[model samples]
Each structure stands twice: as C-alpha cells, then as structure tokens.
Target: FLICLFGLLSHYSDISDMSVYYSISVFSILGMAIIIIYVCISISISIDERYPDEFMNQDQEMYFPIHITDD
Candidate 1:
C-alpha cells in the first residue's frame, strides 16, 4: 500500500518535473519505489497483475523480456 503510493508519487514527480533531472538520487529512489510496487503486491491479486497485458507481463518484465522460444 505505502509502496504503491510512493510509486505513484514518484511517477508524478517525474511527470511534473519535481525531481531535478540532473540528480540521480531522486530518480533512483523513485525507480526503487516502482520496482517495489510491482514486486510487493498482495499475492491474492497476482492473478490480475500478471495477465491480459497482451505481449508483456506487467509484474515481472516491463522493459526487457524473457521469451522462451527456439532461438
């Protein structure tokens, strides 16, 4: 709950340019907040968290992919 709220705040911080673009500390904290949100959600809601994202798993992989196919 708190983690999700922090993530939301940080997301807005970035969008509204509250965190200075030249600093790493603020961005790093926000980044961690976002990661914690995805990882710490209640297990009961995981059914919805991990599905229906079309081509991606929103909970696990938001940037990189772990496609398991013949490559």
Candidate 2:
C-alpha cells in the first residue's frame, strides 16, 4: 500500500497529463501487482512458520489431504 502510494506521488506529474482512463489503468495495475507480491510473500512466511516439521523433512511426501462436505 505504501509502495503504491509512493509510486503515485513520485510519478504524479508523468501520469497527470495523461487521459483519466489511462492514468487509472496504470495505477490499478501497479496496485494489483504490489498486492499480489505482498500476498505471495506473506503466504510463504506463514507456511514456513506453521510447518517446521515439513520444512525439515526433505524426503517426506509433499501431499495435502483434502476433504469435501456440503453445507
């Protein structure tokens, strides 16, 4: 969020003169990319923290069990 805000502030002049549609499109894409990167990093850290046993077991089968139910 801070990165996106900083980017907009830093490049405001470059985008200000562009059409409204174009400016919004550029910022939206930039914001989405930043959010995606943040989510990926967070997930990686959380998985590492939650699964220390799995992290240590190099040869263990890497499969997740799944169950389905109708509400």
- Candidate number achieving the greatest lDDT relative to the actual structure: 2
lDDT of 1 by residue, 1-71 (tens): 44555566666543544443334456677878988887877553675566445334655555545645566
- For the record, the alpha-carbon RMSD of candidate 2 to the native fold, in angstroms, is 10.1
lDDT of each: 0.57, 0.67
Best by TM-score: 2
Candidate 2 least-lDDT 10 residues: 61-70
What TM-score would each prediction reach against the true structure? 0.30, 0.54
Instruction: Give one digit per residue, the lDDT tens place, for model 2 in 1-71.
Output: 55665566656565554464565678779989999999999999998897655656655535533323349
- Candidate 1 achieves a global lDDT of 0.57
- Can you tell me which runs of candidate 2 are displaced by over 4 Å? 1-18, 61-71
